[model samples]
Target: MDEGANIPQYKLFINPFDLKELKRDIWIDDPIPAQLKVDGKRLEIDISYRGSHIRDFSKKSYQISFYKPNMFKGSKQIHLNAEYKDPSIIRNKLSFDFFSELGVLSPQSQHVLLTLNGKFEGVYLEIESVDQHFLKRRNLPTGSIFYAVDGDANFSLMSDLDKEIKKSLELGYERKFGPATEDFFLQEFIIKINTIPVPEFEKEIPKYVDVDKYLRWIAGIIFTANYDGFVHNYALYRNRETKLFEVIPWDYDATWGRDVNGKVMEANYVPIEGFNTLTARLLNVESFRRKYRNLLEDIMKKQFTLEFMIPRAEKLLQLIRPYVLQDPYKKQNIDQFDQELEVISNYIKERRNYLQRKLAKLN
Candidate 1:
């Protein structure tokens, strides 16, 4: 890729000693001191390897936290996704764009070139961190954010890992924002969703969660075919004004016709109803189910079509093609990368048809 390409160029300068220590223990969550130069500005940052399984990959993803009062685009932290498994490399960005278009809150992302000590690392997706800064930048109401770290993040009273009763209601979630005392809000919300009587649940659920936003998020996941989204790969935000929790999507590279492993996932892999205790309980209610059905039907007609999505996919692919060609990690997969547009286009067509057939039977 041309050094002067339109894409952002981020150069990291880490001390050899710190770099060695970081590589020595990839599993550790500790961040080492580093310097980042982007857009001609250099700033001190604390960098750490990010992700669970991907940590083992040759090309690793990174999480960078800016020092106090120093930020990038109003975000104190950011994620640099290696996007190794994704041939297209745009799936994560595409999925996030789709969610935002569908009226769901999602992180903003862009493609960029990354370098370490002046050596080309590869093309990366710079994702905006969904934290207090995220909320502030959007001018949205202040809220507490919690990251669903694993399958256990499923809103079930029973653990998905052990299939037994949970010792703590907040087992799977890691709080990213909010005061310590505010933790009860999520715990109480979980308790209510699980323990409320069916008839009463229909009335009470809306008080704790923004049902409309939640359903839109579910719709985004269903259409994108993010199989893990229901159980995890999401964030919960408790809105201060409404006192309702809203779901936000996270880690969606395993979407849009691909699984987390980058395998070809069938268009119909994820059911229209979706999974998870909160979703099941919501859909059980007559009103919420109808609302979800209507929302899906509307999205099918407007947003999830080939015409609407293909252009967006093409644009992203075009923007990153040059960078991908020069990427040391992904250059070998050029053939596969070139074919992602067709792969994505086909998924949209098949997914829309599947959803259409399923929507009619929703009731």
Candidate 2:
């Protein structure tokens, strides 16, 4: 297969012993030393396999971290998603872009061809890491960031895994940035969300959270129909300047008419009122409910239409088609890949109709 000049190529050179060790212990977060050659430049890097269930897949996702003072396109770290389950291989990128368009802070992503030790790996979605660097790049203030590692990250006093009381408020989150003391703030915020009365909660919630930004994030998740998004698959950023928490999306490949396993999901699988204690509490307030309703209606009328979404999906599909065809890992699902635009188009029409019908409930 001819290497497309338009697609960025990343060549990773790792010691054979380290590569074998990495594969043997895919669950380890420890990165092994490597060199990344891109655009005629070679730089030192540490690489590791990323994701939970995806590690078991034949094609694996990777996390790349550049050594201090050395960065890749202004990012200290990046994620290379194989997108093995996503036939379109653009759902994650498309979802992130859609969130950004909705006035939500989302990671920037692009497609790149990756080769391991000179052997073509496949097309990968290069995702910007959400860390201090991400905030700096956007000129946002220094803050704490926590990744929702599992469903227990849901803002509830009870554990999502088991119906028992959680021992700690910070059960499912992993702190990716900031000092350990920041955990207290996150715990306190969750405590307030689950314990405070509706009247006081409504007035005090805005002091801790960016309400408009949170609602916009809900709209993005609901529009994309990411079932896991309500419980996990997100990062929370607490801006030190504003002292308010904001959300950033992550791992959105299982969206837009598909479940985590890449099976077709019903358009109305997720309700207009999203899940999670925080979301429920916020929407219970009349003002917040009204704002969410208006936001959804406005988005449907403007951005979520077939005319707007189809063209975007088509363009992304066209750009990746050449590379996807040449990917040995994607051979079996080539037919599914070719039909993804139709799948996405149908999902948009159905999902829009479903949301339109359910929008009245918000009033």
Candidate 3:
């Protein structure tokens, strides 16, 4: 990886004997072993085709977990996000950079050229995996990491249909770290998040959660227009220091003027409040509401402006344009890719106007 120009090209070599079967069912229980050669160095890795909607796409995304560290920036796992739905191929990168710039913990991402068996596999957004390594690198306190597996993982208590489902692991939390014994306690945390009385929650929530950071995270999601992230596309980490859960954004290819299913998102699609139960509850608290409004106003003034982002977007487009054109398996043509960049620029402008109008209406 170049310090000045961080994007790196990776070449993957896989044995032909297992290619047919592996490609046929890439999302199997076991990871397929392959040799990844990058920058004149070879390393062993367990690569698997990952994602639900994207798994069926012509250009497949991959989850690459190295058997040994130092293969790629001293990390154990990373995602080669196939920006299949995103014609611009920079939405995730743009949104992730926004979060990181705002002092929030977000996955580090870069554009990378990928080739499998010497065949181009399109330009992929290489994203940092938010696992144990992520926590350690950021010096965040180690605790249970829960990924929102399905729509049921929405923070609303109504999402969980069964009251008897005591196992936190089964409650759609999908514990990625910490002890298994913490499952019962983790379930209790979910219950508190969902069912706690508003008055009590307002008073006691801070003991278990950082309301300020949470509001900022929600603001980031709103700014990026990541509707999927509000409910299901996030990671909730139990902060051992504060003993409160912190929200981390995930699966951002759906963001920045587009939904996960590739539909255009309206500039004002997400309301300032009422996006979800957690947000609604937080906004009900006067202090949190004030802080959230301030955050949004500040972000629009300092961060969300097109002046700050357009050049970066153009640079990213410049970096990935050739790869997109050369990728035979890409879903969209080169013209569509260029058009998507225009659409993204227009979205930033329209969204800024919508937000300014919406901010004025807030009390």
lDDT of each: 0.91, 0.92, 0.78
Report the C-alpha displacement of residue 97, candidate 3, in angstroms.
0.8
**Per-candidate TM vs. native?**
0.98, 0.98, 0.92
C-alpha root-mean-square deviation, each candidate: 1.1, 1.1, 3.0
Instruction: Evaluate model 3: give its TM-score.
Output: 0.92
In angstroms, give how far residue 160 of model 2 lies from its true place: 0.7
Q: Estimate, for each residue in 261-301, the C-alpha lDDT of model 2 and write its tens digit.
A: 98998999989899999999999999999999999999998
Which one wins on lDDT? 2
CA lDDT, candidate 3, residue 72: 65
Which runs in model 1 stand beyond 4 Å of their true positions?
Answer: none
lDDT of 3 by residue, 282-330 (tens): 8877877888889898888888887888888888988877667677766
How far residue 64's Cα lies from its native spot in candidate 1, in Å, is 0.5
Error of 3 at 269 (Å): 1.9
Residue 190 of model 1, lDDT score: 90
Scored against the true structure, residue 113 in model 3 reaches a CA lDDT of 83
